[model samples]
Target: MSEKKNQKEKLWGGRFKGEAASILERIGESISFDRKLYKEDLEGSRAHAKMLHKIGILSREELQKILNGLNTIESEIDSGEFVFRSELEDIHMHVEARLTELEGEVGKKLHTGRSRNDQVAQDVRLYIRNRILEVLDRLDSLRESLYLQAERNIDTIIPGYTHLQVAQPVRASHFLLAYFWMFTRDRDFFQFAASTNDELVLGSGAMAGVNYSNDREFLASELGVPRISPNSMDAVSGRDHLLQFLFAGTQCMIHASRLCEDLILYSSQEFGLVRLPDGLTTGSSIMPQKKNPDIAELIRGKAARTIGNLNHMAVLLKGLPLTYNRDLQEDKLALFDCVETLLISLEGLEEMIRELEFRPSRGERSLKEGFATATDLADFLVGEKGVPFRTAHELVGRLVSECGEKGETLFTISEQARSAISPFFTGKEYDRAVSLELSADKKNSFGGTAKARQIEQLKIASESLKTSSRTKE
Candidate 1:
């Protein structure tokens, strides 16, 4: 009788007469990580219990008891007094087990119209939905930081690079806004991910519809979800929502990684275009004069982890059979890690951007050294001298080569060399063409690097931030 009671306490152990192997318990337990879903799990139970009472499967008294019990458990967990046991296998079981202890057999009825399969699915959707909002908020903050810096530096010029080589002069605002746009797209991706997870899947019991006439729409409403899953089998089995979220996180992190790369490179002594805040950097143990951009470097490295997590989730879902399987337990490891990584990275990157200081003089020096205005000179030939673009390009290329061979820059190139390249190239025309400030300002086309266009872009970005904030509210 005692053995039977123990087996019964296992929840799904009714079919078995033998005890589970200890090793099986060790390998099968998910309460360690899935405990992060405690709030979602408890909330799901409260909704499920209320739905059970609505369908007359549970008494009003039982519903009240279950709700009270769940509330107490939530407090216990919140106060760090809850015990997480591997023997319970997962959060669902732990929650149910605790509820049963508190409310007697009525606690068992909490699982009446649903299974852990759909329960976990619902919890993950809730988790993803909440995390998407957080990511969007962080992205918004970072975008604002970028916008503010751009506004402050509208007149600041920097060398824009292609293939890691300086290609042209651009407003610092333009350079910063480039990242602002990348994160804007990342915010859109996260919003899509949130939409994908909006559907409530709580009514999907295991892999099939339950016998009870439960009101899933009510459950959806209680859970603050906008829609209910249409098909039971797909609802419990599908992991597409999680995949979309992971993909969004991966893309956001990739954008952050790119930003970090620029920060790292620009902060280096070799480039010296920007300086990281001391609070965001670290000192090397062996070097007395080293203030390393470790924060940015770590964010970049963690992006690889987010990418790997996305791949991990994709491969985990690839060969699985329809419906929930034990392998699904592995999903939270990647999901939780990616969420944590992305949130911290976003915060770190935002702080870094907020504190970053740009050296305009260094940027101007790099532009001169790299012949960053060569294209502008070429354009001058085409636009001013009526030289065909191909001829202008060739002429500029020759001038650049001659400057390089003579150990001079465009700013230092002699009048003799300018005449050798093109008879139209006088010292005044060449100087005007190569002026970094003039080159940047001349790009006055829509979305160009000119101060006028950057001001327009900043206004647009500020409006976008306002819209996003309104939507968030």
Candidate 2:
């Protein structure tokens, strides 16, 4: 009895006669992950078949048979009954082989003028477009979480930090809005990435123009692709769009990771500025007193992994030639892994943020140790006493230095000493200048630290998120 030659041997036997080595097959196969692209693949194929029929390349009867077979294949795959063979090299070949088994000769016509190069590119574009929307929705959910937290804590006071040292009193709403702006910028980048790959590369063939005068525009419109790629060679070979996607994804993860780091630090017993619900925290096996911020820690850790994946892809593509190469196969794992990591991280962050609780007084207490109100005192000297800003800043620096030497807060300094150190000072001036309450209230600029402005910003952030969510739906 003779063993059957696998689909790969049959598909490319015109150039090579031997079967692929078992190790080669394992290393080269992408069915496990590329199967995720099956829906996008089928969608592209349907549009291509219709265009082929319209152009008289494939008969209407053949197109019907191919489309029917594709639909059946989609159902089988969706129902988990589809047999994905690794010997097929990748999901594209597995799909093509399955279609051939189902429709005989008509299945072969699916590849008439199309190359696997363009086919893969098209599938990726379709997948990225949908994934961008997925990312947008997740980010919007996060923004909503932030907005709600901001609204609830509009008047709650926390100490804002610079270099991990208390800088000034700030409303909790202002802090949440900081993250809101981060995500808003991330959403903009996601939108830009989606548009970057809007062009259809399906009819470009393998690094060269197609021989047949097929209606590429008709196929493009059918697939909802925004435009046609300008250069056929570049279209088939370029993974810059994927690179853009990775960049956007990495930056978003970085933002999320930074937030996670802050949350973890804030929730620590030492800081005690925030609390993780028992449902969201984990306990150590050996330490009864520990309710660790595991979710935030994992998010922070995964951000590193996501960024490393993006860097791996960038290095992979750096020295490659203009046309397609087998080296490009590494892109699938890099891209798919980044997408999965980002989605998980985004959703997990949204969950954690929704349940987050802040200890406003705990955050406020941080200011007591660090002279957080020193800047405010300087500004007060400049405004109330007509002291030049430079003079006031120097005087405040001297005051802070003196306070450190005497082991006292700015408010504890003697009025005689303050007046002696700076001409701007007077009786009871230290009491008025170092008050956190006054500092917070005096910040009345638009988007300032004042509670009123912070609440206004929260309302705007909440409405913006609501508008985005409605538009997406």
Candidate 3:
């Protein structure tokens, strides 16, 4: 029997008879970062201890003492009174140190059929599972905010853009619902990440099946894991669940960055289409009349770092042949960093959007400069003048260019000038071409730019938010 002073004297201390180099220890240590996993590690240890007792590996009285001692330590940690020692190496040893302090000989029995490798795999999964749920809740809140805004703006017309140039008219609600759908896909990605965390990795015994006749199913159930990992080696070594979550985080950040870009561009003096509230904007240091959209810009820039984190994880896992390796420790910092970045970005964006005020008159003026209603003219020519769509399209193009040459709008062009471009042109055709009402109303197809379709989409988005909130609860 070997009894050691601490973790440095126990498992994994090969090759060093003296203390480790300060730099080496700091690089190898995960406690400062992984202390966040203390709760999950304790939950896993409690489940393993209960299973050990059920299999007659420990006496009933010993099980009671271990369980009771574990509960006390949990309370102390939550109250912030527990002291952590870097000498313990990690949470597993730190918790075991406390258990041994309370239960003496019985605390030694808790390690009968486990290894730190599988234990750490369990802890990371539990942490990611919980964090993904938290992100999903935030996403649902943002979805609801957009849904409410859509409901209010359904009738407001705005210029649709292609290559940052006004292309046509769109309901403001329709543009908002685009984000609603983006968030819906984000929710689905989170659901996939959570589902991948459904298995138990305990009882895997480092890298092989343990010799003990352990009840893995019982251990899995006690840990709230849906099923035991089928292969002990894979269970101890695998990190696909973390990768799945990183990928999902990348998707979310990408969507947020795009939205941030649009908001920043729209709020610029050149666009003059939107005004970000004071809370979300900042003033230039030397300029007296500058209100910069700094928050939106930061959100957009941080997304690149988040995406880089995901790529780092992928490249790290790509070539490793494993049971367990020190390389896996990098997963914690990467994941924690990415999730924290995402949450802050989401919070700032939600606030920015809530305070967003669109300038409809400015938007309408921009829409007019593009001869944006020409598509409506083309459609009318096809329907009423019995002209082929291609001909109507060509004729509309000619009318648009002629208006440009005359330095006038489509409405301001003379009747003779319009007729010179196309015999299909008439008073009714000219009126329909500039009618914003007809442009928006004629687009009533499901999922179109029409106000009615946008309203229906808003109702659907609202229902989605309510259902997702209840699911998270």
Residues 26-88, model 2: lDDT tens digits: 777778788889999999999988988998889878999999999999999999999988778
Q: Candidate 3's residue-wise lDDT over 1-473, tens digit each? A: 33224325644566557655555555667788888898889888889988989999978899999999889889988999888876666888878888888889788778788888888999888888788877987887788778777777777788889998888888888888899899899899889988997788988988988889999989878978887799988997788888888888899889999998888888888888788888878898899899999998998999998899888898888887867888888878888899899889888888887779888887787777778899989988888888899999999999889888888777678889988887767677568766876798788988888777776777778778878878877
lDDT of 2: 0.86
**Candidate 1 structure quality by residue, lDDT tens digits, 267-372:** 9998999988788899988998999999999999999999999999999999998877889899999999999999999999999999999999999989999999
Highest-lDDT candidate: 1
Which of the two candidates, 2 or 3, achieves a greater lDDT against the reference?
2
Looking at candidate 3, the ten consecutive residues that score lowest on lDDT are 1-10
Off by over 4 Å in 1: 1-8, 388-391, 416-423
Candidate 1 backbone overlaps, count: 0
Lowest summed-lDDT stretch of 10 residues in model 1? 1-10
Please report, in order, the local distance difference test score of every candidate based on alpha carbons: 0.90, 0.86, 0.84
Query: Model 2 compared with the native: what TM-score?
Result: 0.91
Model 3 ranges off by over 4 Å: 1-19, 411-428
- TM-score for each candidate, following the candidate numbering: 0.95, 0.91, 0.92
